[model samples]
Target: MFRNREEAAEQIAARLEHHRGSNPLVLAIPRGGVPMGQVIADRLEGELDIVLVHKIGAPGNPEFAIGSVDETGHVELNPGVERYGISPDYIDSEAERQLENIRKRRQRYRRPPTRAEGRVAILVDDGIATGATLFAAIRSLRAQNPSRLVVGVGVAPPDTVERIRREVDELVCLEAPAEFMAVGQFFQDFRQVEDEEVIAALGGESS
Candidate 1:
């Protein structure tokens, strides 16, 4: 397990060395992704920015994601939603609710969304669990027409890594263990990431 996000970032940054000087943009899914993105941007000499996406939780099990929504109100539903008996109306309302939250988050960042046109865009998170939000982020970023899209993370389930691999040009994951439980299980210090830290990271200040 990584000692912390810093160590994880260092490893991901090394794997992404080839992208250095390519004018790549590291757009992190806040708040956990900010620290790692900071290291990657500094190491690759790339621009840092935020990409907002939030999970749409399943009914009765709010922690279980039924799908995810991006900043642009684009929704991507899990195929398993039918198995869960989730309804279209629920999905529609949840997407709206999530879009509202994403709006507030964008305002909090105080920077216009970065245009991904013709430049490599690397989306980083501390780790991936359900991967619903990452999937949503990828689809939304794809709409921006990035020259190339990359997924860099500390750890994820093997299945998740494979699924995301097909969606992006490159996938750099430090660990992809079988039988994963949660993202935090792979980190020794997986604490909650706060808004202040995200702001500091965006401003190029150490948090």
Candidate 2:
């Protein structure tokens, strides 16, 4: 188990030692991944930035992600999202709602996103559960035509790991236990990351 996000970041940075000095771009899924992204970016001598993507929660159960929408309004639905019996209209509404949130975050964070074109880009997150949001992030980054894309997370279930592996060129996952329940269960200090922390990680003053 990780002592905290810092320890986990150090381990992940070690695993990615080969990327040191490569000037890779580290794009973090905000609110949780920002701290780790800062560490990794410093360790690898790369730039740190945020990738905005919000989960499209299932109807009546906001914690359950039906899919996700990225900053560019690109919606990626899960393979079995139709099983939820959600209408197309509902999906459209949810996507727009998420896009608004992404916009607000972009403004609040106040950090200009770095382009990934022709560069090695790495996406970092605290952990992964269903991976709906991360998948959307991957697709969004792919559109930028990064020369190489990598994903680094503290922990994820084996199933999610395999699915993510298929999406990225390299995936650095610390733990992939077969009996995973939640990402927090693997961390001793899985506290909620505050917006101020994210802003500071990006060297922006909180508004």
Candidate 3:
């Protein structure tokens, strides 16, 4: 178990030591991954940036992701999302709502645009649950033609780890427990990450 995100990031950065001097682009999922992204970026001597993607939740359970939409409005529905009986209209509206949140986060973060093409891109997140957002993130980053696409996370379920492993060039995950409940369960300090923390991690002077 990780003491905190900082400890987990340090371990992940050590595993990615090969890219230490490659000046890779470290793209983190906001609200949670930013803190770890800052640590990894500093350790690897890479630039830090954010990739915006939001999960489209089920009608009743907002925590249950049926699909995800990226910043560019590209939507990816899970293979068995139809099992949830979610209608096309519902999916469309949810995608739009989540996309709007992404837009607002983009404006708030104010991170300078950085391209992943022809660069080594590493996507980081605190952890993975359904892998919905990470799936969309990988697809979005893949479209950019990054020379190498890597994914690093703190913990994930065994099934989700294998699924994500197939999507990226390399995946550096610290733990893949078979009996998983949630990401926070694996960390001692799993407090909610506020927007101010994200802004500060991205080198912005948060007010």
Q: Quick one: best lDDT, which candidate?
A: 3
lDDT-superior candidate, 1 or 3: 3
lDDT of 2 by residue, 61-119 (tens): 88889999998899999888887799999899989998999998898888877899999
lDDT of all the models against the reference? 0.90, 0.93, 0.93
C-alpha RMSD for every candidate: 1.8, 0.9, 1.0
lDDT of 1 by residue, 1-207 (tens): 999998999999999999999979999999899999999999999999999999999888878888999988899987667887778998899889989989988877777788999999999999998899999999999999999999999999988888999999999999998978888988899899988888877773443
Candidate 3 global lDDT: 0.93
TM-score result, candidate 3: 0.97
- Candidate 3 Cα misplacement greater than 4 A, ranges: none
| RMSD of model 2 against the true structure | 0.9
> In candidate 2, residue 87 scores what lDDT?
94
